[model samples]
Target chain A: MSGAGEPEVRLLGSWASPFVLRVMVALRLKVVEYEMQQETLGNKSELLLRSNPVHKKIPVLLHNGKPISESLIIVQYIDEIWASTPAILPSDPYRRAVERFWGEYIGDKFSQVIRVLRGSVPGDKDKMAGEMFTALQYLEEAFVSCSQGKQYFGGDSISYLDIAAGSHLAWIKAVEKISGIKLLDEARFPNLFAWADRFCAHPAVVDVMPDPDKLVEFTVKHAAMCAPK
Target chain B: MSGAGEPEVRLLGSWASPFVLRVMVALRLKVVEYEMQQETLGNKSELLLRSNPVHKKIPVLLHNGKPISESLIIVQYIDEIWASTPAILPSDPYRRAVERFWGEYIGDKFSQVIRVLRGSVPGDKDKMAGEMFTALQYLEEAFVSCSQGKQYFGGDSISYLDIAAGSHLAWIKAVEKISGIKLLDEARFPNLFAWADRFCAHPAVVDVMPDPDKLVEFTVKHAAMCAPK
Candidate 1:
């Protein structure tokens, strides 16, 4: 299906971008062939610039030379274009809207994770941890409602919500280990905790995830760069 | 299509919210009958709280008692469920995805408008105006590319992208009046300027838009509230 004259798939991405990993996971899940064009975040390539002029961020999915930027949008595009079995998004529009709602909720948590990491000093730990725990409670409820005892988030198969959450799972573990924030403890967020395990174990997501140690190191470095020096 | 046995549509919205007006515009465009459940944002009603616990903000669309929060999400939901005649979102998934991409871009501008408002002062006028002008230039290009000699954003009919842009048009004018930052002047942004005028002239969007004078008054009041006293 993806022979010459077919759509040429190239992923312009950086190793540090969870957004990039999301496109990778989606592509793998759909069994779409693509080349990963690595781009540094600090010094983005001219190709990356030409691909995505809007935000100029990475994880640009280049299909037949047309680039789609924004990680979530790219994931949806992949879901639509690839149109393989085990659709990540549900068929019914209402159900699709619900999955998208969860995706937006997960995206919101991404920013909160950054704030938690940045403000993870000893004095601010309790406050940040409290916020993180409250947010996790919401995610756990979302998982419980969607899963109904299933392994993944909304269904037995990894749905849109699962991928949305999966993108952040590695970061959660790395943050928990680095900041001692206890993001996804099984005792507290059992449903989500289990969901994370199932998501990461998938070959589609497993190999693409950044090493936890390297991720934490990068986070620390980013935090230092952002510090009010 | 929407009648007895169908879940009653109740909108939790504030008169001040452009986001609320967005849902209102979409619903009106679809000719769907929905009761406006006005919300006082400061002392939010329990319905608003329950419907949108995450943000606890206005513009939650309740259909048959099930709630959908987030303006754009509600817009898409409205477009989906009320698929009788005039389709706001395009049917083709690629076209729909492109519409969504622009919707996200316009939404991004909504926040930048707030930042410009908060940061605007006599000393910061040129800098703020420059940023606003640059953003408007992008919107102009988007309209030119998408319209392709059409009246509305996507076509002659009011589209999802047009609704996205229209929701903020009233506020954009009000902000310019209040801050005196010429954003969509015809010389710089002729396409966007013409588009805004057309969007406001639409019967569905016309009545629902917050009054310019009142909107400016509210915006001034809001700026005062945000100032570090």
Candidate 2:
């Protein structure tokens, strides 16, 4: 629940969605209480449809009856609106741009390559996995630069990049389990592997993070659907 | 030629690239002075490569030697660092999210479909154009909501969405001429049609907008490269 005089907040989300998990973690980080309405897969809620007519997808963050779609945009909106302690993005413009650049890379490149590796898209699996590993190596370098040996990307605090990349940890792990592939190789990607561990263990993320076993089970069941046609 | 105490600013971009034009418009709107380094096609500069190592793409803005890549991110960084009048993004969090949503839609959906329509990628031309028109019509509705009958999506001022969408006007027009297809139909997309005209005529955009004739010629020359194999 919002504090007195605070506007109402609600999140339309699916329990197992990595995107939804991002919003949940952001909300928790901000300590902003809100209602969660679960959106069923295949049968999206009317509220979800009405809230995000364009994408018609979860998670949509509704503040005072207005909807904000897209996880990264929603997270930024939350940060700006709340404007309290524990800033999600860095205040410095350059740093913010760097974080955003990597965040986009995570969404656009890293995740897409992983989709192929996980058999969602028909492709040369080894080639796709190699691309994913290359991207991960780049992200490892990014973490080194951004963290400066700090625990998190934002240097001691979870950040936009952390949430953006960290949200996919479970899905990546599930892919590893299902495909028998080593993606986040400890020796090759020490920074990212350790960072993933720390990110999942973080207070704001732990409760909302998807269960690994459940993800593996879900991925196994959906393997046929995702298999290369 | 920044003012005293202003940081040294430079832009790495190609003259005809719509993405570069976006950053140019934003910089001009904020009245910021900067140097421009034109990058050649297929032959990128070491500065661009070093500055934006992750993507190694153009339209990189160097503010005091620190580089910011991605047109939208650079625009936001300009808006934030300058923090002057004629804001690129709305001050209200919700409005900002709205603009960001539309901006992403332009990049992710509208522009990709246009790529197909222009023969850049092999696809059903008619179907791709239909999708493009649908997206334009949706933008028309978005304009009605965001503009509130005002002249621009930002309500009387050009904004991030306007830049994101409007930057592609020349290419869209060139496609219409080259392919002999009528996109941006006045009858169907009245709001966007009118908005495009207004947007193109704006002082900040007019000077930097690509020449339609040049674009058509370029398209004709490159048509062979883009033809479906």
Candidate 3:
């Protein structure tokens, strides 16, 4: 743990969820030692439900015994608790707001991409593909403008924005295979593609990401089940 | 402002947006002195765009010239900056996390009702209504049960979660009128309906909610424009 007097941290999460991966990356980035418990969604442990009864979702981070749900909230809590090393967010308020804007944008916009890719019918595949492409286009524009040749989304060093966006990389790749629609085309989204490569290469992120091949397999199988006939 | 040495806080928002109303209610509950700027979406002011370039959507709160976007972010920022009487959030980390979970749930789940009510075709309307009903059922079962007969979402006193959920009352009513579907029936959702009434009665919320009749008129007109002939 980074803080000597602070309570020990524990994380409850599932291995395959991109949302769960986000918390893992933030903890690793902050160098906050935490006890990890892999949760099963089918039979969510009583403790997991008790800790986050409102959402009853995974990626719940418990500081001492006080649990914080939502991956972004957990990330902010981690930043607040561990203030020593490389700051994960910018100090300037405007810039911080900008980073947060991107975070919210991803949560609001790209989330739909995941939903569409997972649930799109064969007849509506083209429509879903278009939505995914539009989201990617927006992401590409944001990356090119905000990143400005930096290795990460928030700038030279990896910040929370990179962690936020990076968490989706494995899922995006998995969805590409499952849906058979490559929205993140290198020729079209060079900046986003390059950023994804750099994001996955980061030590903290690399250490936490689920196995890409297994993720692809799982997503493909799940998509087949959810796909509209 | 509640803070001893801080400058006044101002909110830029539209009267129709529930997201904006959340911030307004939070500010009122905190007793923060502020100004209001009603933004027109078609001709967004330079300040609104500059304050929130990425989304350019309101409920942007400016504190000492620094802007905070995202309704929940602005609420937390408001709570942190104005540490005066009648705390809008629980100080306990666990309770605070629970509050946040509900706040996020309202954003994620209830927001979908807008999309459902906006559906144009008969099949789309039925599908969306079914989904909206499912969402309402979940809230009635899970969220109302969790409230445990409290006056607010958190308990006796209002909290951030109450503001988040309460802001949707006008929109919910408007959508119900447009779609001829009432998910928030008084008998079926007694606790939720009563809570909405209490929420609107609260001085903080009462002062800022958009004119309900005007909101209904606007929504009906807008729906007509989008409805299939």
Candidate 4:
């Protein structure tokens, strides 16, 4: 707290957010000390509003008062600022882009996931599940590409891609159990299944995970809001 | 024709697509020479199919036989490889994140623009247009943050953010002409409206614009498909 001239690093985040956890894990991975101010979802704090006026969402990392939003963007920024720490993205430009391609794919899957979880219509639940499976297969292929002869997505160490997709593993498992849908079937996605297990077990990753009971409670409560009107 | 050592660069893209133009302008700005292999929308080629197996979509930049898909990702890759050329993203991580935030906002507006253009339903047309305005106002604010008494969103030189958002100007203008709604109104978005003109007139940007009449014709043809059923 009393470091001379060191920039005050603060995180405006929510315990309910995996995106927030990504930044927290990234910060912890680098051993960067930061203060956390938990944010209420519905009634956001004025500080967050001032920090990230655009999205008005959490996981905004304030570096000496300047705010950086978006989970992937924040994680990358963390890696860059803490250059002394192990690199999250590759040094090579081409490799970085390839990593970024898969990292960005997590965003690509959002709509399909929402449709899958909520169902386009309550009656259309089965139809949307098919679409979600097709989408999950593509993600499985992405994970497999870099998992060859390696433990993590980045091979030896955790990467921006791993943090990008791995943050969702907790939520996915919670959804799977609550919804009773075996989306990440062990046989269909052995690599991703194992990757999720390994990601959750990582000490830094474990530090950011939400309480198990609270997570299930959240998914149950939010299912109606997620469902199509 | 490339020299012996120069990597063989190729772009698999549809002339009708705006995303392809983003990569085109980026390459031109960097003075990187690349051959364009046009792709038909409905009928994709084997090269494109093999290159980008994930999204099977266009604007894939093939570098030395290795393919990089997603226009924004490709643009960053081009910036990285041609490092000496005028940088697209800033060298500073914080600045780069801020820029990425705006670049990413373009994605947020896509659905709003579609809803505005296609109309969710006949009665819902006006409501969608209002949402588009609220969205554009945010983009205008983003531009103002970086413009800072300069010509472009990137200040003097075009940037990743500039290419990301500027690529859509033609579509916005075309939509304005066809719909007569004037989404980017001069008084409301003084900076962004002028930016559209300046961006279009840039030599590199000019080289990538589609045939005006062809663009309008394609829009007319696609209206029925884009409309909510």
Candidate 2 lDDT at B119 equals 70
**Model 1 regions lying over 4 Å from their true place:** A1-7, A115-125, A220-229, B1-7, B115-125, B220-229
Among the numbered candidates, top TM-score falls to 2
The order by descending DockQ is 2, 4, 1, 3
Quote model 3's TM-score.
Answer: 0.71
Task: State how far residue A172 of model 3 sits from its true place (Å).
Answer: 3.1
Better of 1 and 4 by DockQ: 4
lDDT of 2 by residue, B1-229 (tens): 4567655999999877889999999999999988899998778999999998878888999887888999999999999999989988998898999999989887777667667766767788888788787788789899999999999999989999999999899988988886789988999888889999999999999989999889877766678664679
Q: What is the interface RMSD of candidate 3, in Å?
A: 2.9
Q: What are the Cα lDDT values of the candidates?
A: 0.78, 0.87, 0.76, 0.79
> DockQ values for all predictions?
0.53, 0.88, 0.28, 0.79
The clash number for model 2 is 0
Of 1 and 2, which scores higher on lDDT?
A: 2
- Give the Cα error of residue B21 in candidate 2, in Å: 0.7
Instruction: Find the candidate with the highest DockQ and give its number.
Output: 2
- Separate clash counts for every candidate: 0, 0, 0, 0
Evaluation by lDDT, superior candidate among 2 and 4: 2
* Model 4: residue B201 alpha-carbon error in angstroms: 1.3
Clashing pairs in 4: none
